[model samples]
Target: MKHYFIAHKLFLLFLAKFFLTYILLTVVYQLYLGGFQQNQIDGITQLVSQNTQQLMRVLDMDVLVLKDKGASVMVFYKQKYIARIIEGCNAISIIILFVSFIVAFSGKIKPTLLFICMGSLVIYGLNVVRIALLVVLLDAYPEQTAVWHGTIFPLFIYGVVFLLWVLWVTKILDYAKKTV
Candidate 1:
C-alpha cells in the first residue's frame, strides 16, 4: 500500500488540482454571468464577436457584429445575419477546461505557467477563428449549418486541444523528467 501510494502520488495530485481549479474558475464565471445587466451581453461574448469581426475584415469579408435581444450578439455577413453568439459561445468554459487539464499535467513551475499562458492564447485565437469561419461556412452551406457548428467545428477545437495535451505530455513533461 505504501509503495502504491508513492507511485501514484502525482496522479492523485493531478486529480485534486484539476478539480479545484475547475471548480474555482467555474464559480467565478458563474458570478460574472450573474452580475451582467438583464439585457446586456457579457464582456467575453462581446470580445469574441469583436475578434471574429476583425478576422472577417482581415479576410475581406463583409461582417458586422451587433447586440441582439437579451444578452446575445448576432453576426452578419454580406448584409445577412449568419449566427448568434451567446455566453456559451464565448469559449471561457473551454478555456477553463483546457487550463485545468494542462495544470493537472504540470511540469516545472515556470514552464507550466508559460505553457498555460501560450496554450490559452492559442485556444482563444483558434476559438475566434472557429466562430468566424463557422459563420462563413454556414453562409455558404446553409443546409449544413447544424453539422458544421454542432459537430465539425467542435471536433476541430477539441482535436487541437488534444494535440496540445499530447505535445505537453510528451515534450514538456518528458523533458522535465530528463532534467530532474
Candidate 2:
C-alpha cells in the first residue's frame, strides 16, 4: 500500500485537487444561486439568453428572448415560442468543471489563472452560440428537440471542453519538459 501510494502520488494529488476545486466551486455557485428567489432566472441565464438572441438576430433570424416572473427565459422566433433558456443553458457548471480539471493539473500560477480565464470565456461564448443554434434548430425541427437538446448540443459543448483539456495537458507536458 505504501509503495503504491509512493508510485501513484501524482495521480493522487490530481484527484485531490480536482475534487477539492470542483466541490468548492460548486458550493460557491450553489450559494450564489441560493440568494435568488425560487424559480426566478439568475442573471447569468438572462445574459446567455440575450446573447443567444443577439447571435440569432445577427444571422438574420427574428428572435426574442424574454424572462417572465418565476420562469426560465423564453426564446421565440418570428413570434413563435421555440425554446427556453434555463439555468443549465448558462453553462456555469460546465465552466466550473473545466476550471477544476485545469487547476488539478496546474503548472504555473500565472499560466493556470490565464488558462482558467480564457477557457471559461471560450466555454461561455461557445455556450451562447450553442444555444442560439439550438434555438434555431428547435424552431425548424420541433420533433427532434429531445435528441438535439439532450444529446447533440451536450456532445458539442463537452467535446469542446475535452479538446480544451487535451490542449491544457499538452501545454503542461511541454512546460514540464522545459523545466526538466
Candidate 3:
C-alpha cells in the first residue's frame, strides 16, 4: 500500500486539489445564487443573456432578450420566440470546472492566476457566442432543437475546455523541464 501510494503521489495530489477546488467554488457559487429570490435571475445569468443579445445584434440579427417574471430571460429573433436563457446558460459552472483543473496542476502563482483569468474570459465569451448561435440555429431548425442544444453545443463547449486544459498542461510541462 505504501509503495503504491508513493508511486502515484502526484496523481493523488492532482485529484485532491481538483476536487477541493471544485467543491469550494461550487459551494461559493451556490451560496451566491441562494441570496437571490427564486423568482429572480442571478446577476451572472442576466449579464450573459444580455451579452448574447448584443452579440446577435452586432451580427445583424434581429434579436431581443426580455426578462421573464421568473428566473430566466426570453429570447426572440425575427420577432418570434426562440429560446430562454436560464442560469445554466450562463456558464459559471463550466468556468468553475475549468478553473479547478488549472489550479490542480498549478504552476507559479502569477502565471496560474493569469491563466485562470484568461481562460475564464475565453469560456465566458465563447459561452455567450454559443448561446447566440443556438438561438439563431434553433430558430432556423426547430425540428433539430434536441440535437443542437443537447449534443452539439455541449460538445463544443466541453471540447474548448479540454483543449485549454491540454494547452495548460503542456505549458507547465515545458516550464518544469526548463527549470530542471
Among these predictions, the greatest TM-score belongs to 3
Kindly list the per-residue Cα lDDT of model 2 for residues 97-159, writing each as its tens digit: 999999998988998999899999999999999988888788889999999999999999999
**In candidate 3, what are the lDDT values of residues 1-180, reduced to their tens digit?**
999999999899999999999999999999999999998999999999989989998899999999998999999999999999999999999999999999999988998999999999999999999999999899889999999999999999999999999888877435456557
What Cα-based lDDT does every candidate model obtain? Answer: 0.90, 0.89, 0.93
| Ten-residue stretch with the least lDDT total in model 1 | 171-180
Q: Which RMSD values do the candidates have, in order? A: 2.2, 1.9, 1.8
TM-score of 2: 0.94
The per-residue C-alpha lDDT of model 3 at residue 39 equals 89
Candidate 3 Cα outliers beyond 4 Å, as residue runs: 172-180
Per-residue accuracy of model 1 over 1-180 as CA lDDT, tens digit each: 999889999778989999999999999999999999989898988999999999999999999999998789989999998889999888899889988988888878999899889988998999999999899899999999889998999999999899888889888778456657
Instruction: Give me candidate 1's TM-score against the actual structure.
Output: 0.91
Per-residue lDDT of 135 in model 3: 91
Q: Could you tell me how far off, in angstroms, the CA of residue 123 lies in candidate 3 after the best superposition?
A: 0.5
Worst 10-residue lDDT window for candidate 2 reads 170-179
